[model samples]
Target: MFGLPRPVKRLIVGAPVRADGQELDLDVQLLLLMTRLENGDLAARTVERARRGLERGQIYLDRRPSRPVRTRDVDAGGVPARLYTPQGLPPGSPLLVYYHGGGWVVGGIDTHDTVCRYLAVHAEVRTLSVGYRLAPEHRYPAAADDALAAYEFAVTGAEKLGADPEAVAVGGDSAGGNLAAVVGALAARRPAFALLLYPATDMTVRRRSRELFADRFYLTDRAMTWYADHYCPDRARRAEPAASPLLADLREFPPTYLVTAGFDPLRDEGEAFAARLADAGVPVAARRQADLVHGFANMWPLGGRFVEALAEAAGALRTGLYAGPRGRGTTGGGR
Candidate 1:
C-alpha cells in the first residue's frame, strides 16, 4: 500500500466517476471520441485521429515560455534523440532524462517538448526527452534500448553537458513510464530517482481494470490492445521485462515517484509496480490522480486545475529529488 505521511494527505487522490467527469474536461471528451474511432476497427482513420489527438498538446507547448537550451542530436540505441540544457549551468548540477507517453506508437520530442521545458526549468535540472522510434516500425525493447542509450549518454557524457553524471534521474509518462521502470531495473540503482506517470507495466490484456473499463474509461481495452499489438508483434517477447517490467522480478530500483490516474486502465498496473518496489525494498512514493484521467499531464489547455496537477506532480518530484539542496522553490508556473 502507498504510505501517506503528513503532506501526503493533502496530496492523496480519489477515483473518478463517468458522469461527473463530463463537466470541464472537454479535451478528455474529444480524446474519448478519438479513442472510439480507434476502437471502430478502422486502422487508417484511427491512427490518423490518434496522431491528431496526440497533437492537442500543441496549444500548451506553443504558448509555453521558451528558455535558452541547446538541442544536440544524439544517438540512443540507434534511435535519434534531441537533448535540452538550460542556459548557464554550473558544473555538477543534476540531470533528468525523460521519455514521452504515446502508448509506444505515437509521440516523440515534438509532442512532449513544452512539458519537458517546464520540467527542466522547474526541477532546476537539465531534462532530456528521448525520441525513441515508435511501434509498427520499431517494436518492443527498441524504446527500452533507446532509453538505456539516452541514460548512458547522460551518465557517461555528463562532463560535455555540465551535469553530474551520477545525479541523473529517469522519468516518463504512459508507455514511457514502462521504459522508466525497466530502465531503473537495468541501471540497478545508479540514477538518483525514477519518476513514472501512469506507466503501462503489463502488456497482458487480462487485467481487471482493462476488462471493467473496456470502453467507458478514457483509455479503453481495445486501444491498449492496439498499442501492445503494434509494439509486440512477437507474442513470446511480450513476457520480457522490457515489454512488461511488472512481471519481471526487479531488485534495487532507485528511489521512485510513481504517479497514476485513478480512472486509467493502467492505474492498477502502475500501483502494483510501486508495491513490488517496496516489497523489493526499493524506496518509493506512489501518487494517484484520483480525479484525473490518463494523460492528464498533457491537459494544460483544459483548465487551471490541470496545470496545478502538473505543478503538484513536479513539486513532488522536486521534493523527492532536491529536498535538501533547496527548499520547495517552484518553477514553470505561468498558465
Candidate 2:
C-alpha cells in the first residue's frame, strides 16, 4: 500500500461510506480500510507494538512536502520539545505550543513533525511541539503537569524564541487537544488562543458519538478505554478536570477554535466543551467536518478534503491569533 502512487491511492479511497446519518469522506474511508487490514484492532496490540506501528505508519501518511521551516530542539521546562519557525518569519511573531495526538502512549514529536511544520508554514506562526512523557510509565497528571510547564515555558521564554509574548497560543489534536484545553483552563497565564482538533474532552462519560461511531473509525471505544486505563489507571480519577477538560471551569478560557469530525467518537464531547466555553463568555469558533473522521489533522498529506479541512483550521488559527478580540458566541459551519 505504501508503494502505491498518489493517483492509485486516490482511486482506492474514492468510494464513499454512509452510516449513522454521517457520510464518511472517501479518503478517510480508505484509510480506515487500510488500518483494519494492517492492524486489526488497536486495543488488541501491546503498547510497545502500538507505538512502533504508529511510528511506522506516520512514515507513509505524513508524506506532505516539507516546509521551509527552521527547526531546533528545545527544553520546554524540562520536557523535550521541538521548535518550528517558518523561514522569513519576523521576530515577535505569534507562537503555538503544540501537543501530538497519540492517546498519551503512542505518538511523539517525530510522529507529528509534519503537522507542526505545516502549521508553522500555513498559519504563519512558530510552533513548539512538546514531547511529554507517556503513560503507564509517567501516568495521570504527568502529561498534564508537563503540559502546564511547557505552556509556562513558552510564555516566559517567548521573547528568546522569537515569539511575541502576548501572542502565544496552545493547540493539539486528540490527546494533545485535551492538554491544550486543560492548560487554557488551569494555566496561571492563559494562552492568547487555542486550536483543538477533535479533542477528547469528557473521558468519564461515553457520549452517543462514542457508541455510534465507536468501531471501524480510526479511534475505537476499546482503544479509548485502553488509553484511559494506561494514562489514568484510577477510573475514579478520570472525572477530574485535569483528565476531563470538559468538566473544567472554563470561565476564563482564552478564545478557541474547536473542530470536530462528524464520524469521530469524540465528536459530541468536543462540541460540548466548545458550548461550555461559549457559555463562559470565551470567544469560540466551533466547526464539525461532516464528512471527516478522527485523525484527519495527520492525514493532510493525502491532499484533498483532508488538506482543505486542515487549511481551514490554519486560517482560523491565523485569524484568531492575529485578529482582535472576537465576540462571545459559537460560530459553526464546516464541510
Candidate 3:
C-alpha cells in the first residue's frame, strides 16, 4: 500500500527476525527507509531541535479533518491537556486520559494530536491528551506527578468534561506508556484499564532486546540511554518503581492491555511486565506486533497494518473498560 517495490516487499516479509517473532512488515520497512532518509539522529539534537524536527515530520501525515469528533484545549487539574470528544457520543461513554510518547523530552499534545483523535473516534471514547512538563528541566518524577494529577482530574472532574468518572482509562506510548504504568499503580483508585503501547516499563537495567535490537529498530538503544539520562539523571531515582514501573507491585492494577512491537528495543521488558501483571492476578490483554517496530502506532504513512493495530487496541479498550469484571487472564497476539 505504501508503494514498496515487489522485491523489497518480498525481502521485508521474508527477512529472518529475532527469536521473539516474525519479519518486519513491508509497510514498516518502507516507513523506516523514509524516516532514515528524512530525519537525523534524535539523540544528537537539542531538545528544541528534536521537538521541531518531530513536529515538522508530523506534518507529512494526511491531517484528516476531525468532523466525527470535536477537540478543545483545557486545563486538566493544573496540567495542560487537549480534550477530544466524539461528536454525538451518548452520555457516560468511556473516557481515556492519554499521554504522548517522546522519551519524556520532545513530544507534546500537538505531536500526538492525531493519535488522540483516532482513539476518540475509533474507540468511541473521550480522550484527554496531557502535555506534561519535559525532561532536563522538569526531570525525574515531574511527569509522573503530572500524570497522577491528570488522572485524578479526569476521574473527579469527568462530569465537568462530559464523561463518566467510573469509565475513565489511562494510556500512553513509550515514555508516556511508562507514565501510564506508574500512574496505574499509584492512583488512589484503579483505572478501568491501561492501554500501554510499546511501553518502557524498566529503566533500571538494559534488557536482552536492548542489546539485540539496539540499533536495528526505529528506537535505538543509544537514544533510549540518552532519554533515560535526561529524564532521570539520578540513577537511584531511575530504579524506583515510580520511574521504572516494571519493578512495581502490579497486583492491584486494573484490567490492562499491553501492545508491544517485536522489533522494538523495549519489547522484552514490556512483555516481561505483562507477564508480571498476569502473575500478580491482573486481567491482561497483551499483543505483540511481530512485524512492526516501536512507535509504529504513530507512523500513519505505513497504512492498514498500523491502523489494524490501533483497532485492536481500541477493541481492547471497549472490552476491558465496558465489560464486567472477571478473573485474571490474557488473550491476544501474545501469551
**Backbone clash count for every predicted candidate, in the order shown:** 1, 0, 0
Tell me the lDDT of candidate 3: 0.83
Judging by TM-score, tell me the better candidate of 1 and 2: 2
Each prediction's TM-score versus the true structure: 0.81, 0.92, 0.92
TM-score of 2: 0.92
Residue-level lDDT of model 1, residues 1-335, one tens digit each, is 11234244323322323532333233344445545655533123465567666675365446453556656776744666667766654456667889998888887788888777767655667777888878877887788888887888778887676676667788899988889888888764467788888899977546666665566656677778888888887888887888888877667678888888766778778898999999998888888766567777766544445677777767666666666233333333222
Cα shift from native, residue 311, model 2 (Å): 0.6
Off by over 4 Å in 2: 1-15, 64-66, 326-335
- Where model 3 places Cα greater than 4 Å from the true spot, the runs are 4-21, 65-67, 326-335
lDDT (Cα, tens digit) per residue for candidate 2, span 1-335: 53477678668876568877888866677778888778646564689988887888888875644557788999999999999988778788889999999898879999998888888888888899999999879999999999999999999999999988888999999999999999999999989999999998987888999998888888898899899899999989989999999998999899999999999889999999999999999999999998998888898988778889999999999888776463322212111
Span of ten consecutive residues with least summed lDDT in model 3:
326-335
Among the numbered candidates, top lDDT falls to 2
Model 2: weakest 10-residue lDDT segment is 326-335
Candidate 2: clashing pairs of residues: none
Q: lDDT score, residue 328, model 2?
A: 21
Candidates sorted on lDDT, descending: 2, 3, 1
* Candidate 1 worst ten-residue window by lDDT: 326-335
